[model samples]
Target: MTTVAYQGEPASNSSTVARTLYPAGSELPFTSFEQALDAVTLGAADVAVIPVDNSAAGRVADVHHLLPESGLFIVAEYFLPIRFDLMAVSGASLDRLECVRSHVHALGQCRKVLREGGWRTLVSDDTAGAAREVAELGDPRHAALAPPAAAELFGLRVLRSAVEDDPDNTTRFVVLSRAAVPAPHTGEPTMTSLFFCVRNIPSALYKALGGFASSAVNLTKIESYQVGAGLNASRFYAEIEGHPEEPRVELALQELRFFSTEVRVLGVYPAHGHRRTERSG
Candidate 1:
């Protein structure tokens, strides 16, 4: 059986994605993202399911910094609709709850409920961990904001369901493996993720990105981050909506490489169906 690694307790969003992707696989949870990625790198696990960003919370993990340094390649992407529940041990009453606990992101995502309740907040390492803590505390005064599955996992009762501030909140997760598995260029929707550093010269970034404009390539996302504590250079992580093997994409990359000091293709995979669904909606 396959062993899937993720950075959360069972029933956390990452765990849910891993289970959905590999139902028969065994799950291995780690305390941190780096540990989960390391498991895949050291052959302890086949792959790691990691959250990259959330529509409500912005970035969940520092993937831009972590991915480049981990030497892992993205194999696939999954979009999960986020849902948080207010849960506590059996016999806990919503009216009696005085404090809320969850991962920082979960607390942030459920701001509407938190604001209405006006409860004190405590940040835990992960949502499931918060649920487990609530269960262990056995206090009706302390409730947790956690995934629905987490309520069942830790035997906590759901006092409120789907408490996220935004009904359409979603998180984007990436599957990482130690080796590259670029999807075949079969003309379907595809996403190419890459990292590049432009040479430190006047208009270097502008020139580096001009190729995409000239080639009519659609860049879905681009974000620049400082590297090595150096103000003179910056690294960019970009996602473009085409396979690198395509002619126009190839031409754009050729131009990009000419102006860049370094360039690395992180992954080229089939775009998630959610991308189309989201756009059409």
Candidate 2:
């Protein structure tokens, strides 16, 4: 059976994704993203399911910084609709709650409910961890904001269900493996993720990205960050909506490489179904 690793307790959002993708697989949880990725690298787990970004909270894990350094490749992507539940000990009353606890992202996502309750906020490493703490504390006055499944996992009662501020909040997760498994170029919708560092010259970035526009290749996302302890050295992480093997995409990448000091193709995976749904909607 596949051993899936993720950075959260059972029933946390990451666990939910793991179960959805590999129902028969055993799950291994770690305290941090790095630890989970390390498990996959060291052959302790087949792959790691990690959250990259959320609609409501923006970036969850800095995958741009972590992926290249970890030497892992993205094998697949999943979109999880986020829902937070306010939960506590069995006898907890919503009106009598004095404090709320959750991961910082959960707290930020459920601001509407937190604002109405006027409760003190405490941050935990994971939303499920917060619920576990509430159950262990046996304190009716302290409630946790966590995934709906977390209440059942930790034997806590749900004070409120679906408390997220945005009804359509969703998180994007990536499956990482130690080896590259580039999807076959079969004309299906695909996403190519890569990292590149442009040569430090005038208009280097602008010139580097011009290839995509000229080739009519659609770039879905791109972001730059400083590298090598120098303000002048900038590296970029980008996602484009085509397989690298395609003629236009290949041409664009060639042009990109011509102007870049370094270029690495991180992954080329089939695009998640949610991307199509989102674009059509």
Candidate 3:
């Protein structure tokens, strides 16, 4: 059975998505995204499922900065609906709870419930990990904000369910493998992920991206961050809605390369059906 690596304790949203993608696979949880990616790179796991963005909380900070250097390929994508529950030990009461703990993102996303309760906020590594800690501590004064599944896994009682700020809260996860497995050059929908660094010339970015507009290639996502400590150089991570082998995409990439000092294709994989559903909705 394939061993899937995820950045959280069992029952975390990442783990939930991993199971969805690899139903019969064993799960290996890591404390952080880097460690999870390391597991796949080191051959300890078949793939690492990492969350890139959340609808309510925005981008997962760890993933955006780590992916370019991870030396892993985006093999697939999965969308998991995010839900947080207020949980505590079996007999713990909401009135008696003094402190609430969870991942920073969860705490931020569920600010409404936390603000209403007036509990001291504590940040933990991840949501499920916080729940496990609460269960192990067995303190009536302590509660956790995590997924409902986490309450069941950790033997905690749900004090409140669906406490996230938005009902449409969802997280986008990407499965990474050590080797490149580009999507077939066929008629099906696909996405291409790449990293590039443009030159320090004036209007370089505008020139580089002009081809996409000319070619009618849709650029779905683009993020730019400084490389190392260099203020003059910046690297970008982009995702476009076409396979790299396609004629239009190829021409666009050719134009992009003319203005870029470096360009690396990270992956070309099937776009998750969730994107289509989300767009239609």
Each model's TM-score, in the order given?
A: 0.98, 0.98, 0.96
All candidates' lDDT scores? Answer: 0.93, 0.93, 0.91
In the order shown, the candidates' Cα RMSDs to the true structure are 0.9, 1.0, 1.3
Give lDDT tens digits, candidate 1, residues 1-281.
Answer: 98999998988999999999999999999999999999998999999999999999999888888899888999899999999999998898878989999999999999889999989999999999999999899999999999999998899999989999999999999999988999999999999999999999999999999999999999988888997666868999999999999999999999999999999999999999999999999
Model 1 lDDT vs. the true structure?
0.93
Candidate 3 local lDDT, 1-281, one digit each (tens): 99999989888998899888889999999997888988998999999998998898889955557888888899898888889999999889989999999999999999999989999999999999999999999999999999989998999999999999999898888899999999899889999999999988999999999989999999999998886676776788999999888899999999999999999998899998988998899
Candidate 3: stretches off by over 4 Å: none
Clashing pairs in 1: none
Clashing residue pairs, backbone N/CA/C < 3 A, model 2: none
